[model samples]
Target: MPLNPEIEACFEEMRDIRRHLHTCPEIGLETAGTAAFVKEQLDGFGIDHQDIGANSVLAIVEGRGPGKTIAFRADMDGLEITEETGLPYQSRTEGRMHACGHDGHTATMLTFARYLADHRDFDGTALLLFQSGEEGFGGAVKIIEDGLFEKYKIDLMFGLHNWPGHAENHIIVHPGAAMASEDRFDVTIRGKSGHASSPHLCVEPFAAVADFIGGAQSIITRMVSAHDKAVISITQVHGGSAYNIIPDEVVIRGNVRTTDSGVQDLIEESLGRLADGLASIYGVQTSFAYHRKHPVLTNSTPEPAMKAAARVVGEENVRTKELPAMGSEDFAFYMQHTKGCFVWVGNGMDSPVLHNSKFDFNDHGILVGASYFAELLKEVTRQP
Candidate 1:
């Protein structure tokens, strides 16, 4: 691999960008300040591009030789977690933090942007997508709807997530789903409310709610095929207002995830039936409401293209952890339009899990990720 010395020097500058953005975290697509920061860097490189749907920054570097247009993606949104890293440049905006490492993702891509602007190695084009609202609100989908392909005409896309714990310089890839589809539901069980002394005369929604939670847990364990994976968790359950009085209603909120749309549909069906069954058994009224979040994030593996890209980084750095993650990513929206793989680079086992109140993006993974993006660009351009 031909690593540019100037590109290597930009790592420190990339680190500076990461820390600056980390101090002032933004929430969603309305990242005016963050967008401006990225725009300034793109301007410095003299690379021309357009902003789609508010905060997503797209820059194109036309390669020197010959090839097709391939795009590189990075997320820029932060989470609603308070900072605890205690770094001198800790989050200035209290209760908002770069918990998902988008700070690093954004800066790393900026590093690659620097690399490409300096080297300009191949032909065709390189698209640097700095996306926002990826933590929620389907940012990738919003960009596509806003005419990403119509404007740039991307052929193959590549994205990497700063993963937690494996090793530095480690890269991963494969085929099929790399991440699961996430859906959420809320239920309200209703029953007649009466005095504690009149137990026989009144129906309790709490009883039905408890029965439903228990019954819902069984749906994944019993109704779902043992081989087929699924997750059903009741995150919240609230009912009685007093120890003795039977509450009029109980509310339960939960989330479900699966590797395919079929499994997600099954989860919805089973929950509805289970709610009906609980209502029937308890002689109470029950209601279920569901919201589908995002679809499966898959990659084309065997994937000589992606694997060759990984090899450019190094064989040891290439990982085989192709198992689907229950956590959902909006990048799934991008994969729907182009054949690509979303790989996770280790974030560190010791690091706080994403979205945690104390979580902060680790700075050490900067070059590891920048190098991966730079290498992937070179590899993809080399192929048809």
Candidate 2:
């Protein structure tokens, strides 16, 4: 089916909603304003909804009869970037912007909810999830721990992200491993503090930090298979405070991304072993803390979901074999409990990359996304 006229007509309103969200982007689990905005809209539609976690919102739409229950999730958190888009509705909050198109995601989901509420042509229930802290705060985990799945029986769940490189309105879905797993580590190296004049008196952890940082890459290049995809990046490093005195300790922090769990385990083990070996050689005490944040987002059963997308965007516009991205998503948490698929909608190649200061969600993709969700709902909830 082509884009619904009702949804096409609502594009302007959805764009306005997206712009309003972009103006006041919130970060992490502190999305009180965003949640309130979503709740107000849901209330306007007279749809039953409730608050999950501290700032996430969940809304339900019941159909005429009993069937399978499905879910659509949209992340509501913004990045730490300051807006450089310079649009009339630019972000008012400094150092916070919806550079990842989450504003667009929320707007699309809201539009879908409005449509579903107005027309009850299907069976079962439709759950709309406005998740927060998808950036790194584990909002999905918090909501699940709060008994989200236990409260509602969802058979299948689907989520989408706006992609910058593909053509506008194009859809990409993968059967397995749509996105990589994310794991963070903090390594602290401790050594004796001494005066700058006394070179031999201090153990000097700076050397150990340098050695470990340089050697950690070997985990991916040598240890991991070349056929498999994995990445280890040292994003942060903190060491000496004063120029004259050698600090007692230095800390290194970074993240690892992989498509396989075994590779993830190998990376963590290699990191700890590298840190330990470096500390011993440099005569420093080392502490390595590995935090497994989000697992790999794999689509165990993607045929039905992919077919629904193809029906909406036409088979030519639907891509089923796109290369998986190295970026991570917390939606992996949902896939652990229920069979789900995470797809990517094109945000246009002209648009800036995600997390960039100037990036804004393409308003043109709103109708395409909302219509796709609506179509998927019809397909999944069809009476058997």
Candidate 3:
């Protein structure tokens, strides 16, 4: 599909910006350099912007008349993985890389910012949010705490990511849940320590640990409904200090993902109950802590996204029935307070999966994503 000619014209500059960001990848909430670069670009475009949240940049583009306020967010953090893509623009920062395509997302948002600056023909305000710490750093929450919703009466918001394993021109929109919620848990089982040979004399905590791991799976199979989707992964177990010594306490850590809020609630409650049950049955002291890292990303207002995507790619290329990804995104937190949707623009059918050392954001996504946001601006601005 041919992109908007105006947006297509910005491809070279966009690619340059994306490559520049790829070289100096920043991680977590420490995105000062990246935010400075974004602010510079906004200034060059004659757009008004300010610092918000932890090192986040928010730019404003006013329209011709009064209408609803819309927002576009792009994450600006990289991962701890080293870049192995071998591109000339590969990361210069060791032990950090834009493996998740946040660099590209930032570039796309910048492209749209430039376009909106020259042509603010819509009827509402456009907020260009360059967010930081999206890679599990609580950047979005920090921004909310910093008064994102309290300051602006935003009517709708939107965010997009480049998705690999699909055609480059494809645009995927989920009408309901787009990404799963992330919950982390730690289970500590305490018991008596003794010699390894004294199996009967010592209250080994591994028995309770083993039972908790097995019982955690039952929560999904037996407790959760068959129609609901959920996963409980036991990622870590730390216990023994020596080869033969029975440790006094065993710590178990795991992750949970679900598309439904009720299922999230169910799994958390069930895991706590199972931990208590294991303690009572094995005569061990158990403590469980569950932390909700990110909420489930639901498309509260998907029609505007669908229409905007149809305008960018062809109607046939806009997919609305894709299953929710098990992966989580901090953008989900914004959905809880506003009306909007998160979308996926295809990176490429043969591209490497996200967060892999070999992964790189497909540069063509810059035009595709920018065009979609431009169209979405028009869609929301016309709303009552």
Maximum-lDDT candidate: 3
Question: CA lDDT of each candidate?
Answer: 0.80, 0.90, 0.94
- In the predicted model 1, the residue pairs found to clash are 63-122, 64-122, 65-122, 163-345, 163-347, 164-347, 165-348
Off by over 4 Å in 2: 195-201, 241-245
Considering lDDT, which of the candidate structures 1 and 3 is the better prediction for this target?
A: 3
Please say which candidate is ahead in lDDT: 2 or 3.
3
Per-residue C-alpha lDDT of model 2 across residues 138-230, encoded as one tens digit per residue? 999989998999998889999999999988868998889999999999999999999988859998888888889888987888999998889
- The deviation in Å at residue 133 for candidate 1 is 0.8
The deviation in Å at residue 246 for candidate 1 is: 1.6
- Selected candidate, larger TM-score, 1 vs 3: 3
Tell me the deviation in Å of residue 314 in model 3: 0.3
Best by TM-score: 3
Of candidates 2 and 1, the better by lDDT: 2
Count clashing pairs, candidate 2. Answer: 0
- Candidate 1 yields a Cα-based lDDT of 0.80
